[model samples]
Target: MSRIPDLPGVISSDEIVASAEHLAGLQTDSGMIPWWPGGHCDAWNHVESAMALDVAGLHREAERAYEWLADIQRPDGSWHNYYLPDGDRDMAVEDDKVDTNVVAYIATGVWHHWKCTSDRSFVDNLWPTVERALDHVLSLRKDDGLVLWAVEADGTRRWDYALLTGSSSIQHALRCGAAVGLATGSPRPDWVDAADRMCSLIANEPLAFQPKTRWAMDWYYPVLTGAIEGEAAKIRLADGWPTFSMEGLGIRCVSDEPWITASETAEASLAYASIGEFATATDLLRWTRSHRCPDGSYLTGLVYPDKVVFPEGETSSYTAAAVVLAADAIAGASPGSDLFVRSSLRPS
Candidate 1:
């Protein structure tokens, strides 16, 4: 099995391995990966960390992470927004909100693992989990074809809004879910239809989703998720270039914010690669190295101009995972690398 390879004159392979190890070390005995020690964990970020482990050739640890997810998944196939490492409440007010995108991302993660290891048995084992999660997510789809952002703790749905970034992510997850279905000979035409409709809204009708113009993720997620493509994807990136990108630094988390985030920068790099702009992508990934810590983990983001660490000066497993995944995509080191670059999720 191929692992993350070295990017000559850029980041070293040893550094990539160390970053993966850093993420793995963050995994608790329950196989959950918190943002940092004593930090809370979320489903989406946990899967991101697991994918990084797979990219680093730590299949055993990665599988254990997935098993953790499967073991703890709610009966409805959704996970709460926050969890403590020790499975205890760290905060007084627990967030019981269930995010549709968070639930849907297991499909992407499971499919990614199968791609990396070519493990059919593993895919088969995970198929039911993927199906149930997607079912929950797709159930949140509105008549306008966009999935609701979240289900509130009161059991009321956030039907009045849909997020561009979240919906874009769910579209990718739906396709991956459908692909998993097809691979297992249990095709889900419903998921395909939902994904196609969601893609149409994202590509043509920008107003369909809630206005989050300030966030960089909103600008690039359609491209990153393969919903926007060709000249349109290029134009999207070009349109938002000045607002989100920082030359020789990294992409900002929000347009009006001076915080440069490693995860957003790394994700933007993948979006660039999706549009065949490898040079631009490579530079973005190279720039993220500045956020790396001595222990090989990556900080969440840096407040610009002052160059100070923001958000409590913490390093995140997801941020380190994003860097590792971006490096893999740029180096073409794994089959899973093409997940971002290609439109494999597009409905046939």
Candidate 2:
């Protein structure tokens, strides 16, 4: 990966590197990056952290992170929602819900690493992991094209509803998976079909996804995942601006809530950049600086007005990862930054 250049008024490249190093320091010897020391790790957030590592030129650590994921993957291609850093089960959350988005994200992470480093060997080795992960995720697809959010511990799909953010994110993952298939001479036309269908569902049928409109992610995730674009994306951002955004503190976690989170703010910036709104993206990124700690790590979010850290003052590796990704997008630092803006798979 090329060196990330400094963005003078927003974040310096040195600070970006320092943030990445902070995340790297959090990774356990087993390669898992928990939310914090003694905290649990989830597959989705773990991949996000690994992608940040790749963007920061920590290729070896990124590879090890993926290898750790590969080592622990369930035979059915699913992972429990959370785990201890030492590869042990996180028993605190008794619910063993296997999240579709968490499983599907490996494809995005694998494809991202390949894009940043051009490591064909890494992609080839990880191809099976991606293939199986997608297989599990696609199996959760309902007839209407929305992927069910999770599989219960009973091995049944959570058919009650799908999430707009999760389904939108899965669409991007499917496209990345298809791209991996094509690059490796392993074409997955089924994944392409699923992606096209999912995009249509996200673009045309908001009602199909469960009503989580109260959350900020529901507003911008479709655009961030490339399901919504062009003028539609601009309109989406405009529609939710008054409800979700605060002037300088960052994006609120919920419209009615006072909490502003680093991960959501960073992701919102990506949504803006995906639509060619670089200035707005930069402005949003500047808000993220307030969430940064003296050591270059980011707080998960803050409760506004009171101006206190949320979740009892946790600073998460995933939150740090989100900031790194937003910086990369704004600076055009890595090929992976284009993952959110690129078109979906074309049928062969």
Candidate 3:
């Protein structure tokens, strides 16, 4: 028998529809899912929100997003980190190509959605985009299995730093890709090995440099991305409950201070469930609900008064993805059931 979903209360169909409707408004005709109604576009947020739409049974919106990504993909298969409402590039790295290593790895989610609905056309249309993106990213892999943060077409430093987050996400994308290859009878060993190396590296050694930030994503993403597994993964979860986690609003981006944000919080909460911590996952999901906005958008951060930063009022596609992803975890959709993370672990 299928397990019953334990969603927050009896959220009316109307409420879910309203939330979905608000999400629909965020979608531009160009197919990009902006953060707020008129906020900047980001690759990370795009894939994250697409995954959310997939889980919600909104395949068309999600497909549109992938198409948007494909249309804007650089010749080398990379994308800038950000863009404007007019589709004009903004805040791009020096190379104008993004290191979106974490962002590009969302193929796992895409393939997972494909498996659920048996949508061959979605797979056919997106296969090329996924392939090219992976090909570009795989070129960045280092001998140690860690990818350079970002390299320009001319080969210059973008992020110029190795991030544990990037490695973990790549690992996830590779795994998801491998799953797709197997299902589609197109298994690629190179991709799987690359993902394996990334996971092995992170598990054996700490690669993420921002240790000072009290962000919980650093603590849990390793496992969530499949870098650590079995007893080790479980142990990491037990050890990290206090190390990087904040009590209420969710995990901070790092351990440096008290900086809490919705996306990271949701990501961390989902991470908890990734390792089978249902109790904590349930709590974090509840906390996230309290922050839900009237129009179904979510708050970005809580680093107020002390952090002299304008609280961006717009809710983001990534933020929405984080929220829905966390809810899916609470509803028993975990890494075991996660296809997005799996395909993300695959090669192009």
Number of the top-ranking candidate, with lDDT as the measure: 1
Residues 197-303, candidate 2: write the lDDT tens digits: 98888888878888999999999999988888778878989999999999988999999988999899999998988887778888999999888998779898899
Which of candidates 1 and 2 reaches a greater lDDT?
Answer: 1
Off by over 4 Å in 2: 87-95, 342-348
- TM-scores, all candidates, are 0.95, 0.95, 0.85
The C-alpha RMSD of each candidate to the native structure, in angstroms, is 3.0, 3.4, 5.0
lDDT value for candidate 2? 0.86
- Per-residue lDDT of candidate 3, residues 1-348 (tens digit): 122233655223334445555676788888877777777777766777776666666778878877788777777777876676674423333334567474456566667567556777677667777767777788776666678777655656555556777778877787677666666666778888888777767888673343423456667778776678768978888887776556765666666656667677777766766666667766776655644678766767666325322264545567656777666555643332454233232223
Reference-based lDDT, each prediction: 0.86, 0.86, 0.65
Model 1, C-alpha of 188: deviation from truth (Å) = 1.2
Model 2 RMSD in angstroms: 3.4
Q: For model 3, where is the 10-residue window of minimal lDDT?
A: 339-348
When sorted by TM-score, best at the front, the candidate numbers are 1, 2, 3
Runs of candidate 3 with Cα error greater than 4 angstroms are 1-6, 10-17, 87-95, 100-103, 157-160, 207-214, 303-314, 333-337, 340-348
Each candidate structure's count of clashing pairs = 0, 0, 31
List of clashing residue pairs for candidate 2? none
Number of residue pairs clashing in candidate 1, backbone atoms closer than 3 angstroms, sequence gap of 3 or more or interchain: 0
Order of models, best lDDT first = 1, 2, 3
Q: Candidate 3 at residue 216, lDDT?
A: 67
